[model samples]
Target: MNNLGRNLALWVSIIVMLLLLVDVFQPGNTQHAAQQLAYSDFITDVDTGRVRSVVMQNQNVSGTLTDGTAFETFAPQDPSLVSRLTGKGVEVVAKPLDQEGSPLLRYFLNALPIILMVGIWLFMMRQMQGGGGRGAMGFGKSRAKMLTEKQGRVTFEDVAGIDEAKGELQEIVDFLKDPQKFTRLGGKIPKGVLLVGPPGTGKTLLARAIAGEANVPFFTISGSDFVEMFVGVGASRVRDMFEQGKKAAPCIIFIDEIDAVGRHRGAGLGGGNDEREQTLNQMLVEMDGFESNEGVILIAATNRPDVLDPALLRPGRFDRQVVVSNPDVGGREKILRVHMRKVPLASDVDPRIIARGTPGFSGADLANLVNEAALAAARLGKRTVSMREFEDAKDKVLMGAERRSLVMNEEEKKRTAYHEAGHAITAVLVPESEPIHKATIIPRGRALGMVMRLPEGDRLSMSKKNCIAHLVVAMGGRVAEEVVYGKDNICNGAMGDIQMATRVARSMVTEWGMSDKVGMIAYANDDQGGGGMFFGGAAKNFSEHTAMEIDSEIKRLIDEAYDQARNYLHDHVDELHRLAEALLEYETLSGEDIRQIMRGQPIERVEVDETTPVNRRSSVPQVSGPEIVQPGDKPENDKDEGGEVHPVPQPG
Candidate 1:
């Protein structure tokens, strides 16, 4: 029934019940207010012929007095009593005890409780089944959403970046719309296409766009929907999903995060006899069984293609593997512009500069960057998102939120300035290192100082020279600490720097084959293992002595990089001191400022009083003359008293 009719029926039934209660009980408000009389007086009145009329039912009696007032009292349920009332010259009558409503209400009230209970039971059943009458069964039904024509609003124009992957899928979209174009030529279209990429690279968005372009029914589901706790439920779901797709005929079934169920069986628990495996087996059967699934294009996305079952990737199944990698610089610019279209951005906010600054950002990351910039602008009570806010947002995304509330002592601040100055100076001196983008002494995230380097362009691969130069620049912080504060007074500011340098050294020795002892061979677990990507796969194939040689080689590389850093800093001590002083005075410096300083003047090797600058510059730097060490030579007067240029302990 409609809601209003149902409600009206309910209220009418309730009113009928209330009326029945009133008719049966006959509340005192509807009875006459009469003078009190004893049973003997009632009998006297009845016998004296003073009563006009009387009625009796069971043990109750009702009569009207001579004055036309009605009265009621208890009496025996007897026919004799009524006869006596009739013979006393009084009119007698029966009460007929029926209520004043229609008889249908009686029947409806009796059946109303049953109807309400049945309706509630049905509602609970439908809820447990899933929803509506269609889900009246258990969880065997497919959960794939079937979007009809014009349902999905996302088109190809909405997605930017990952053009190669888009190009690969465009043909799939075309085939979905006109399948006979390829079928008449005996060319079988691929039933399944796998989109492989990292998270947030628009894999799912691209799938939706394809659905929009095809103008057909779109079925979207995740792989987890196929797997259930029950043994056969998953397999039944898979069959049902395929059945749905087939009924929809010209439809696109996009399975997101297919890896959840597509993992390699027998690799983990249950020994390939789990519900997921059964689901996968049923999926394989329905996908490429005896009958060909025509016009039901299946597309799935995953980040980890390594663990997928081989059967899922075979020729007739997932024939095409389109990789949706992070976009390059140009693609990033396009994505930024696409996201910025909705927000009011200032003219100074150039997508090119933002893209250049963000080299490794995916499409989602760029979108988030734009959102963060807008949020920053809004937080500052600004209407337009400016480049300054974008830059700050990028810094926040990369380094972390600014720790403006953190307080630092003067000594700590001075140490942070020198540490940052060392990084900037090394970056400027080292030829292979990328240019220093910005240097700051203000605390951000967990670091006390920061030196951000922006590469001229994205580097797909790093050279060994560049790697070593990075190491040298990384050690510059500790190198300066040792140069100014002496080895005993160096703090733990270079803990992160040391860790990065060690990792590079290890990678060079184990994976990159840069170690002299390792030759042109990779000893990494990735190169040797049949093991999983996450779980440490295999032990390196080498003797204990060879392992010792590898460790020694790593230490030696670090030592050499550190020596190079120390030599560079020793020669440019005057520049290092000036830069540190400038940093102390400004508390920050931009890339342009560093470049200007580098181009402005060469620092003369002249001594200054420790108390002269008031910026707390270290007093250890002294140059005898203008002569300094070249690339292959070492300084003469910087060695220790032992006359041995031994390896020094880096900070932390």
Candidate 2:
């Protein structure tokens, strides 16, 4: 198009130049030349009648002679006179002399160039506005990219970690490939399939694979592309998109993030006149208007299918909604392997280990893992990616890279080490708690230290006791600091821990029905309504007396758990100090190192003096009675009597 415009401008300029040259060189008047030569000879032959007659003959031939004028009937006798008369009698009309052409014709000719230029300008503008041929100016054409079999090379094998979703979509591919096989048995292919899951689960990749497998045209676009600033542009775009799909029959239209446009109508504050509602209405109409067995299929993907309108998920529209969730260990392994193929890996690098390390990674996460590993190896100037590099890469992906530049003073470092060691020791001591896999005092991301624990397995159900045990483990760090380093060392490190513990405790007391005072009274809403309030009620179902009792019970549970952690650490102070020192040296400690320390030394049993009063000897009541005698199985506190001691349960 640019070249065409340039060529047209050049041709117009050339035509104007040619017209100027013609006007400059061409003769304006030839008749005036003859009259000048004739007058010169006529003066020499003034007395000769022969000359007069010659002049008359010349005038008659030139149509300038009067009927009464004497003229030569035959040829002139005098040669010079004859020549002069022949030229004189022919009168040349006075020629209008001007260098330039006529004003009207000149203006028309000059303006012709400007007119032609303007015409070409308008043509270019029209081409640009109309998509060069596709449609009108500013028309909302769907920006969906079409991929044909020739350009699409992805297959089912190319995508990983979404097998179930792929399996559901595979039927669509089969229909496209062999429609007759199903049609002969009176089986009708579904009009649409909705890939529903969180982001980065390979929903779009599966769509491409289908396109490649079926060797058909694939039109891919986002749900937002259907919306426009104009009120009806979205609906117009939807109509145009379906029309194009119909032209390319046996094709797939993949709409990514369909919830953007398919959000439930009349749910928001905006009423029926909403622009998005109009677009969604048009989409629903188009979906229902299409025949089921027309060979054209619609495949849409959304992370938030919950927000989409129910009409879009009806039988005639999207009948099947496949969930593309985070991959399991096996799926992770496959996804890792698929990504690993692209990187130069060491012989010792095992993707299974990487897969096991990342439990909740999706296909996109695995791909990023591979890219990060490559980058790590590149930074190290290594030829092949090793297991250590992959591990570093995984850590970098999960939490950010270790910030060596995040400087800390000796006091801060020691505090962080003790805090992390406390969490690890508590996790190891508590039977219901998950095992601590790694504990590090190194500053990574915003955390001064972190203790990573591994669950026994993926848990879909959790008990009240389990929740309380987890909270105890979370609170152990601050509790340990208070018992050993005194309350002064406890900083903002426990904010997140306290928040998580409080939430768990609330869940146990109100929702899980674990509290004795508020048993089975679920104050939490099932839906966890979108608003900030957890539940709509201003007060609990129980009376004020019961509420006080519930509050007291909750505080007692938390205090008991904190005191238990403190006692455990106080008994093993030497080991705790040793672990903290080791952590300071290495910046990290494994679970095995922690277990070895606990096994090497035993805690000394504290003996009470008979001289001390029974009531003053213990703070916690024994047997839930007035007596203050220490429980038989309770670990004695080595600290002051002001310190609490958890009543250790008796073994069966």
Q: Identify the leading candidate in terms of TM-score.
A: 1
Off by over 4 Å in 2: 1-140, 149-152, 268-274, 290-293, 525-554, 601-652
Cα error of candidate 2 at position 26, Å = 25
- TM-scores of the candidates in the order shown: 0.74, 0.71
Summarize candidate 1's per-residue lDDT along 116-227 as a digit string, tens digits.
7756876787666446234334468788887765533888888887789888888888788777888899987788999998898999999989988878888998887776
Candidate 2 lDDT by residue in tens digits, 1-652: 8546776787678668756654564364323332232443444444342232322333322212333233222223455644454465533232233476576686566457656776787576556543424333334666777876664399999888778888888888898999999999999889889998778888888889989888898999888877655578788888878877888988899998898999988888855448788999988988887443387789999888888899999998998988888887778878887887667766556565566566567788889988988898889897777666776676667656777888888988888878877777788888886555566776666667777555545444566666667767777788767766888756777766665566667667766777876677765544544443322364334456766766676777787778777777777777677777777887755555566656764322222232222221233221111211111111211111111112111112
RMSD of each: 12.3, 15.2
lDDT of model 1 at residue 633? 10
Among the numbered candidates, top lDDT falls to 1
Residue pairs clashing in model 2 are 53-71, 53-72
